[model samples]
Target: MPNQAYLRVAGLSKRFGSGENAVAAIENLSFTLDEGRFLSILGPSGCGKSTLFNIIAGLMAPDSGDVTLNGESMLLRPGMTGYMLQKDLLLPWRTVADNIILSQTLHGVRRSKALDAALPDARACGLETMLRRRPDELSGGQRQRAALVRTLQTGKPLLLLDEPFGALDAITRLHLQELLTDVCMKKDKTVLFITHDVDEALLLSDEVLIMGSQPGRIIAHYHLPQEKPRTLKTLALPRLIEIKGEIMQLLDQEVKRHDPHA
Candidate 1:
């Protein structure tokens, strides 16, 4: 059986413009992320994947829909939901530790206390030595690790990730995905991460949603039966590939469905 769900999205729908110009990004879209579980959403470009992300992050409003958190209705706003983007978005002048505590300070957490609190998790992500270093001095993976830590520092239950490692090279991307899976599990965050990469999504998500384009909707939902402590070796498991095939087949038909005239 599946784990108990902690985050539930009901009848979620979003649109842009009006009348003929209006396009539904994701309509009547819904899914659940159990407490401390990770979910990855994958689809072709223009699939409204990012738009769906915006609504979940509360950066944009849905035409009609609502998100519930840990059984209570969520009142989402900027800073309430910690979002990590494709870029590290780190400040060059600030040290890693400073960046982590900045949000806490803004949320009225005392600087000294926030720093004291972040040390344990920061060290867990391989940032113990780099906390004092500038962003320019860190490797790509290290920088992303900081961003992940900073996201967690918000102390929010959900994390919206928009291809947080998509820009990195293949080798780096794989390395960071494994590292990120470890970090997120340790933190027990409910992650709604977006990705166009199939293997990455399979490697990280406990559940994978395969989305279709324009007037977008969920075409298939895959529940991964694997347990936690997933490693790179998990990718080689036959079951992983089997489920990945199902998602790929859905996407394949989705592309043809959207471009039959082309």
Candidate 2:
């Protein structure tokens, strides 16, 4: 039997404004992510990638359809998923450790207990030595790492990441990409990541969904090989390269569709 979907978006649609001037950010967008699976979404800008994420994260409601997680409706539970944006968005006044446990604190977890729970993830993300430091004291990569730890510490089954590494340098981005996959897999967290980078999506995803613009919708989906320890070496494989090329072509088409003059 096919794997059951841990998270399902069914005929989801979202619109802004009304009447003839109305705009549809998402239209009949649908996809399923299996439990503990890593799915990445690739699309051109204005493709409603972020909008879709916002709806799933329960920050926004869809005009129609529903979003369910673990067989339960997520639409009724806003903030059910752990969400991490491109910027670290850590509280500069709070120490790294404090920031990491911010969500737990909000959920009424005692600080001491939260820290105890956060320690393992902190160390795993290489933030153990800097926990006592403020966000401004850390490098860009360090900050994002702390943000990631914070997201994981929420103990949410699903994670919604919006280009978390987009602003980082190439080297730092690669390191965090590897760290993220390792951490998420070990924790068995389902992730829905949005990225403009095709290689990054292929490297970190169990499956990739390509989206088209002008009322965003899925254009194609590819299930990747179940290769362990997916690294730079994996991206170099001929099959991966072929898949990457195809994804790039699809994205290019979407870009032209959005702007044929370009």
Q: Which candidate is the best by TM-score?
A: 2
Q: How does model 1 fare in lDDT?
A: 0.83
Listed in order, each prediction's TM-score against the native is 0.91, 0.97
The residue ranges of model 2 lying beyond 4 angstroms of the native Cα positions read 1-4
lDDT score at residue 123, model 1, on the 0-100 scale: 83
Worst 10 residues of 2 by lDDT: 70-79
lDDT of 2 by residue, 61-136 (tens): 8999999987788884776999999999999899999999999999899999999999999999999999999999
Candidate 1 residue 251 Cα shift, in angstroms, is: 1.2
- What number of clashing residue pairs does each candidate have, in the order they appear? 0, 0
Looking at model 1, residue 147 earns an lDDT score of: 90
Clashing residue pairs for model 2: none
Which candidate leads in lDDT? 2
